[model samples]
Target: MNDSLTFCKAIEALAANIWPAEITAYLDNWQLRATRGVTKRANSVLAIGEYPQLANWLPHIEQFYADNSLPAIFHISDASPPGLDALLDSHGYALGTPSLVMIANSQDAAAAAAQKLVKRDVAALTAEWVTEADEEWLDAFLRLESYHEELKESYKGICERISDAKGFVKIRKGKHIIAVGTAVVQGEWAGFLNVVVSEAERGQGLGSYLMQALTAWSREHGAARQYLQVVASNTAAVSLYEKLGYQTKYGYHYRIKYDLRPLATS
Candidate 1:
C-alpha cells in the first residue's frame, strides 16, 4: 500500500473507537457497525482494507443488517477496496451524505482557539468539563442533533461505552448553557464529537468558546492532534473549522441499498 492509503486506514481504525457502534461484526475484513439506526456512523460499514471474495461475501453482509432491520450501508474512504464503490453503484446502492475528516495539530488548534477566544470577546463565557454526561447535557445534545427523542438510549449507549479518556465540555453564560462538545482522547488524537452552539445563540461565536475549552481538555489528556468529521453540506461548520486551523484530511460517504428483508421485518 502507498503512504496515503496506509494513513487513511489508520484514521478509519481510530474512528471505529471514537464513534463506536453498539454492534460491530466482520465479514472477512469488512467491518459492519450498527446502533439500531440511531446514527449513520454507528450503522454503516467501514469498507477499508482489501476486498475479499465480495461477490460471495456481499450476501452475508447484506443479511447481517437485514437481520437487524437496517439497510446494509458502506462507508467509502480512500482506504476502501479499489472499485468497491463502483461495484456497489452498479448493484443499485444509492449514494449517501459525504463527510470530510478535518485535522490540526493539537498545539496549532489550541493556539488558534486561544486567539479566537480572546479576539471574539467571549470573556463572559465560562466553560465546564464533566467526565460523565448528565441529563441536561444529553438533552441539549439531542435537541441540537434534531434526532428523534426515541433514540436517546442509543445515543447514551454510544457515550457510555467509550473506554478512552473523554471530557464533555459545556460553555455557560451565567446559568444558561449555550454550547456543548465532547472530547475523546485516544492515543495522539483527540476526536471532537457532538459539538453544537444553541440555535438561538449561533452567529455569536459560542462554538469557538466551546472548541477552545475542548482543546484544553484534550491537551491535558495527552492528545497531540485534533480531528472532527463534518458533513460536506454543512458549509458554516466547514468554514468555522478552517478558521480554527483544521484542514480536510479525507472524505468518506455511505452507499446504501434498502433490502426487502427490512420491509419483511417491518
Candidate 2:
C-alpha cells in the first residue's frame, strides 16, 4: 500500500512477466509459479497478499510441486502477509537463501559519472546482438552451468519473453568476454539482473563498470529509479552496490519443504 511496498510489488510483477514460468496460478492475490524447478524464483509461491485463503491453498500448492518433482517453496518478503512466516515455521518449512532488494535513483550524479568508464558495447538482446555476443561470451556466461545445452535454451526462452525495453550486455577484453548483465526498463523503474564478472576478472573494477553501463542505459531509456536483488550473505556484492548509491529497501527469503520420501526399490 505504501510506496516502498508498491515498488517491491512492481519489481516482482516485472520479473514474473519477463522470466515466464511454464505454469502459473493465483490463489486470492498470491502468485504460484513453476518452471521445472530450474530456479527457485521461477518456482516458488509469492505469498504477497491477504492470507485468509492460505490454509486451503497450501495443500494444492504442495501437490502442484510434488507433481513436478520440486520442493514446495514460498518466497517470503516484507510485503508478504503478516504471520505467514510463523505459519510456515510451524509447518516444518526451512529458510533458504536470504536476499535484499536494493534501490537507487537512476539520475544520481555519481551514477552518471561512472557511466563514462564503460567503453565496452552494452546492448539489448536481439538478432544482431546475439551475433555480437560471440563464443567467448557464451562460454563465460555458461561457466556455472558447464554449458548445459538445455539450460542455455531456457535462458534464450527467458530472454525472448522480455517484452520490455531491455538490455543484455556482455563486456569483452580482447577475445574473452569478462562480464555480463541485463537491465529492463519498466515505467520509472529499471531492474538490473544477472550481473556477473568472470572469476578471473573480478576485483579489477569490471563489476562496477557493468553496473554503470546498465545504469546509464536505464537512465537513457527514461527510468528514474533502479533496483536489484542480491543474496544478503554476499557481503562483497552488497558492499559494491552500496558504494554505488543503492540502499536496501527490503529483504526476502525462500521457505523450502523438501520431499524426503525414499526412492522406491527396483
List all candidate RMSDs to the true structure.
2.3, 4.8
TM-score of each: 0.94, 0.85
- Candidate with top lDDT is 1
- Per-residue C-alpha lDDT of model 2 across residues 105-138, encoded as one tens digit per residue: 9877245436544553434211112323345444
lDDT of each: 0.85, 0.73
Clashes of 1: 0
Q: Candidate 2: list runs displaced more than 4 Å.
A: 1-3, 52-55, 109-139, 144-149, 260-266
| lDDT assessment of candidate 1 | 0.85
Worst 10 residues of 2 by lDDT: 124-133
Candidate 2 scores a C-alpha RMSD against the true structure in Å of 4.8
Per-residue lDDT of model 1, residues 1-266, tens digit only: 78988888888888778778999997677789989997788998888888866556777778778889888889999999889999989878899999999999988888887787675768678988888777777877878767677878888889888889988877888788878899999999999989888888888778777888888889899999989989999999999899989999889999989864632322
Error of 2 at 31 (Å): 1.5
